[model samples]
Target: MDRNFARALSLVLKSEGGWSDNPADPGGATMKGVTLANFRRYVKADATKAELRRISDDQVAMVYRRFYWDAVAGALLPDGIDYAVFDFAVNSGPGRAAKYLQAVLGVVQDGRIGPATLAAAGAKPAGVVIDALCDARLAFLEKLPTWPSFGRGWSARVASVRRQALLISAAPLTTTVSVPSAPASADAVAPTAPPAGAGPHTGAEAPAAPPESVSPAKAAGILALIALALGALTAWAAHLPCNLLGVFCQ
Candidate 1:
């Protein structure tokens, strides 16, 4: 696992802080963002509310690193992207966070990060995916039923993540992908090259321009000409009966 991820994750854990039990929050009785239910599940020991009040920071960090970070494959992701995804997973869930990254990468949204996801993420620039993911996250948060009560805080958190992620990703080594010295084992399938026209087509020819518009005066003149032709036709039709007969009938 990337050591930098742990350092950055520490910052996120700090921001999340310790112990919140707002009635509006659905998590209910969260300590360091780990709810009472999760803590019980992770610890696997029955503890009273009084004991939960004494939950340590170290315990929280372990739960986050194992359940949240490892689940999302944070160590393999780009620096800024890992933090964004990790924090998002903590806020939302692992499945949603993985699916969100997949959505931005334009890959399968199976809610699990695997070979395909890692390959796509590594191939693309981190900034582009980070921007898109953050935008999508905000748009999603805006539609939630709880937005009226928690929208401001959610928006601020996303913004903070976006800014910090970008900053972390801006580091020289952050975006670099390392290649293995030896070939992969038999089970590993190497990433294939993208198909033709798969990447951005910068040199694509511009579309043909639309036909020019005619001025109002020019349009009126054309209409007048059509009217004159109709008038002449009418006059010819009116004289047809007289011309067909031996004498004038009109």
Candidate 2:
């Protein structure tokens, strides 16, 4: 019901930390969880591993906010569910993440997070959705050929994501419409899924989807630091004081 991009992104970055270029990784090489392709499209066309390794936090945040977070409609989604889906989108491909989320919601398995999906997701409690979505995500990952190498790490990540997502759902979330994975499996031909939050693009999802529209809430909390920079992307009314969930705290 509100925008939680900053908070959500912060949590995700905790998991994405640093750079890695496992040759077994289908996404090739990545920096701060971004694939070489995404870096090329967003920051540099001729971006090299060296440049990717040194990607600034600002750039990393920009890519995740516009691509991964927004693609999963993080701003519109409930707190915990928003994080769960965003992390899922980052770890697996956004298309597959959206479909799994829809599966939990019993909505059509279209790989997009449109109004219908929003409404369905909103109707359910964020905690329940987080649990179901995480379970489903693990189930899918467990069956992958790479599970032997990444399964334990993936399970740990999903557990942590579930735990944190539930915490967000429990707390009143307030960051509202903000920006916006990785993967392979039985659906190898389906969409790309980064090995456990490894990347954020896959499947039929466009490299970038327009950030979902969201209603503005009073900019509460101290983290409105980027309110100005975000501009039209996700501006909170700084004058009014509200909690992270956009509700008056006391």
Candidate 3:
């Protein structure tokens, strides 16, 4: 694997406390504390002592495989897919991560960590998820150094790897491209127009017809009609031919 890739893998593994000589035994550890031993057992529920040892070996190999290293031949990953797969494996376990990649790539979601699935893992080219994992690993490393004596070496290794991963992640493969400017042409220039009606254009809105003003005489005529109607009502009330008051009294 590339030195950078190896360094990154080592850092992640170290951050997780997977590289310790006195690695915790998975069999008796409680899940609550979540020591390396418990984590291994959580991933490999049915393995025996010998089998458990083998799981450790598998874990290392899976890490390399996902991160672009050939465990048997000792080769480095040649593509970003390996990095992504490695990250997913580290976060979700090899089996579950492979399954997710398969589902994302639309192959099969059998949860088997294999070459085809690893190949599919690279389908999403952007390294957002892997970068996120790297960030997490860095944070874990920063805190690991303050942990108890038993974790010192592991913590140191994690811290080292975290620094390396950050460096690698910093040098992104993709770059942003600026939009090209159009050439200045005579046709592109907007023409200047003369002010208002001075040129062939008139920018002013036409004057609206003045609202018909009500004359005082027209208003007085309406008032006079109303007054006349009121006067006729008063005359009727004062004893007209109908004589309503006289009839009521009778």
Candidate 4:
């Protein structure tokens, strides 16, 4: 197992708790965070509800690893980043988790974690990425039909995930466990503060982020497209057959 895998899973389990068969929950039944359907697919093809309830630690670990961790390519991701994406994957689907990760990185949202996505992620500070991703997660969860029923626990989980992810990102990892989180309300949400032991906020604040990188290829392609459009317009205005850019000027 990767070093961070165990740490991340441990934190997630706290929010999952024992056995839950809440009818309102679409997951139906979950044990140690693994839904029965997933358990059946992974551990036992014909697994019964009884088997899911009796799911062991080892089985839980396997399901998480194959379905969640590997799906997000967690091993290649940075410390806290891996946990953030991993938790989101467990709660949401891995594809959505990957897309969320991509969205925050400002890369193409292809719903797959690959080299381009990793490059974009590594360019930004992990803390910033985690905060952005958590904010996006909360925004999305609030839109769900079930939000009225389960929003509180989801909020709490997001808040806890954001804080703990930041902790592990900065080197010397904390042994302290994290609870689920977000905010009870806009007025009630406590802002995430700097980690302990950092002295008062002195000195000038960091400068604004630099501009997006220039893409010569994209620029060239766009310029070519513009030229084609211009040519098509000229052809149309002149009442000639339109051939430029496949723009039909009948």
RMSD of each: 25.9, 36.4, 22.4, 33.2
Q: Each model's TM-score?
A: 0.67, 0.67, 0.31, 0.68
lDDT digits (tens) for residues 35-105 of candidate 1: 78878878647865566668887777777888889999999888788988998998888999999999999
Local lDDT at 241 for model 2: 62
Candidate 3 Cα misplacement greater than 4 A, ranges: 1-5, 18-81, 113-119, 128-250
Candidate 4 runs further than 4 Å off: 172-250
Q: Judged by lDDT against the true structure, how good is candidate 1?
A: 0.83
Local distance difference test values of all predictions, in order: 0.83, 0.84, 0.48, 0.89
Residue 119 CA displacement from its true place in model 3, Å: 4.8
Question: TM-score of model 1 relative to the true fold?
Answer: 0.67
Candidate 4 per-residue C-alpha lDDT over 26-115 given as tens digits, one digit per residue, 9 for 90 to 100: 998999899999998999999988989999999999999999999999998988999999999999999999999998998899898999
The count of residue-pair clashes in candidate 4 stands at 10
Better model by lDDT, 1 or 3?
A: 1
Candidate 3 per-residue lDDT, tens place, 107-165, comes to 77786545665454434443543444444544543564344543455445534533454
